[model samples]
Target: MSKRVHIPEYEQESELMAGEELVGGPAFWFLHLCWWQEDLRALVERFGADPADVDALSDRLTDDDAPWPVFRVPFGGGHTAVVALRNFPDDSGIDYFVHHPEWGRLGHLGQMDGHDTGPGLSWKELTAIAADVPDGAEGLTDPAERFLTLLPMLGDIDTPHDAAAVVARALTQCGIPPEHAPHIAGKILDNSFWELPSWVVRDGSPVPVCGASASPRAIPLAQGITAGQARDLAEALSGERKA
Candidate 1:
């Protein structure tokens, strides 16, 4: 008698993994964890995928490791669409993920540029903040599964508690250290919406900004603001109390 394969169920679909290759379809974007690139790609390539712009996201992830910056990707066989930059696992040199939510139907944006980075700098506070973050293992939905899918980016929340369940669950899944789980969860919440640095150039060349409309169009439309100015603006928005 042949043994039955065991597959876990998720909110997305009741069906077990259609084998390993078809996992994380709708769950990659709002996923909360920091997954290094090399680990990600190896799993994807093992399943037979050719992704363009794989190195693209790798560059973006290495930088700041903010939320996710977006770039166009042609996956499997389709036109290039935007997906979270540099965060995916790319085994070969191909881009496997795209922004065609309709394909699997998940809402995701491709950048985290303008995250109101500089809030009052107190050495103690910075240290406190820096101390957060769990190990990578606890964030994966399937820890035992070697090829973890960093999918379905987690959404925004009004308070830390709202997102805590999701964060805690992810931490548990990935098996991150308990002491640092809250810290990692906090960063995940902070970076959930992705605020990119405006005025980025295509192919790494600067471009003029006509106006800002959040991404692609958000390259400093009005007079450029200094770092301090940007900080003030963020403070004002965050009400200083929360941020």
Candidate 2:
């Protein structure tokens, strides 16, 4: 279960190295949305993998303790895709590589270096997003819970509709019926919600400090505000009015 059965050769390869060019595609995005083993198995099968290999790859990926997990997915006619997970201190992301019989490993996929705009949504922004939820929207009551539910989709959200889709997905994940989830999502976005105060980083952590007179309360960095947002919050806390 720890090693991939589809491509056992990869088990001996060094995990430290990856392709130079990061890549992504429909499969990559689909993989991002998959959190459960069954869904992953389905994805592997769709890529023309053997039934046994499909199960093996899915199990290996879901294993939390698997060291430097990597897998080769068959894409038919001798072409394969190599998927690896890159871990960081604060986050982890997947990278993809194409492998062919004639040519070895190709470009890397899904590299975010120099492309990421840092953290996506701030706590205040998330609060604003959650505030849009209607008074009685089922399973969306707690602001903190709503924020955590929406965290995975934050980077992809650009519009209110995108936010609604994320909410709908979250609702579905919470066991709400698919048909009802969208209806509830629409209702959640129909009204505006109140905003929370911005936060400043004090002692390498986020502290909720709105204005000059407000007392700062230190909170974990997991609160989700970016460094830039923290600086602005600091200025506001210091009573330095922006010109």
Candidate 3:
């Protein structure tokens, strides 16, 4: 028997408005996954391209340098829906716009306030792109890996259960067997396997400036060291312990 998930009435309404049958949970999750991967890739490429000037690299890593078009969905009539993260100066969220072949760009469909809100684009205006996402693409096949990859992007979620629900839903959407979502979620929570960066608003814009964020499990894996060796890695990274 399939598990009965209880979606809030507001979310149900949003789903209906967005065409639940088309850009449902799977498509939504896939869009976010694409954005997350692209954002990381852009940052790494920038640093790799100019590794000599650390200060210049830091200055260039602002929202202005972020790669756009988190993902695109092509529709009939030569129209395409482009999804991307809202500029930090505007607000921290996701938004989308449609593009016509001859007419140029259309206006935004809607904006979602992080993962707490509804889909930014509607199915009436956008086609399902999740179905076309190749399996194992970007090396994101394992449920645990997917959850960890998405953890940093989930800073808006406060409640533990809510975060777990998001992970479970995304896992199921991304082709993880439905029956295994609960177990995977449990393991993730038990291990506490991810770290989140701290953000601050600078000159009226949110910036991820703190680089000392570390998780108990992540430190060891990051340094390719055993748990015993990483016992003080978090403290050292945070400058809480002397070398």
Candidate 4:
């Protein structure tokens, strides 16, 4: 839901230069992510996306607004949405899918390599395209967080391994010690939102850029991972034992 999500062109450029809040006429172009069935619901929910912003995106979706110009994406849940300058790539958007059930709704499904789309497009094609349009998305950012939100959308994943990985990543982003991570992978089902795929569509696929941001923020997985998982990753990566 690129432009469908509602990010202004000018603000899009500014965000890339510096990942700061939108400071323009109305809204900015960027992906809005929701987990599980909470996609659209999260928009107006108490802690959901700002009302002003939702109002802006809603306006665009309901009646084509300027800058946004058009928003033709369809949402299946209340948990995920992407606001940007243009619509998400062809066959690239999603509301719900198989794989994980507890992670929530995965907005970007076809974009992940070797997963989401079910290899409909060759891995070579995905890899090549992703390399050129690494972000596939023109104005999306925070791929890491987006990825965390998509963990529930993944297919062919080993619950233990994937869950452990997600828990570990969430711990780092949340600024918690890796040693304290619970290290549990929520669970997955074709209709489940947990264990989602990457939300940031890289060349129309899900990918994560953990630690890529100067100021890292926790991914939605923070909602699932326990302290034990994180500490495990920390120990494995740093070989440091905290007393």
Candidate 4 TM-score, true structure as reference: 0.28
Local error of candidate 2 at residue 170 (angstroms): 16
- Residue 120, candidate 2: C-alpha displacement in angstroms: 21
lDDT of 3 by residue, 85-177 (tens): 444544555544434434322423334444332222211111122222233332223434333333332321123446566556656655555
For model 4, how does the per-residue alpha-carbon lDDT over 107-209 read when each residue is reduced to its tens digit?
2223231222321111221222212212233321343343333333333232334445554554345333444333212222223332322222233212221
Q: What is the Cα-based lDDT of residue 235 in candidate 3?
A: 29
Per-residue CA lDDT of model 1 for 36-149, tens digit only, reads 222233333322223343344335333432332322222211212222233333211111121222233321222332231111111221122222222331112242222122
Enumerate clash totals for all models, in the order shown: 39, 6, 0, 67
Best by TM-score: 3
lDDT of each: 0.29, 0.37, 0.33, 0.28
Worst lDDT run of 10 residues, candidate 1, spans 7-16
User: If scored against the real structure, what TM-score would every candidate get?
Assistant: 0.27, 0.27, 0.29, 0.28
Q: Model 1's lDDT to the true fold?
A: 0.29
Looking at model 3, the pairs that clash are: none
Between prediction 3 and prediction 4, which has the larger TM-score? 3
The candidate with the higher TM-score, 2 or 3, is 3
Candidate 1 residue spans exceeding 4 A from truth:
1-108, 111-160, 191-212, 215-243
Quantify how close model 4 is to the true structure by its C-alpha RMSD in Å. Answer: 16.6
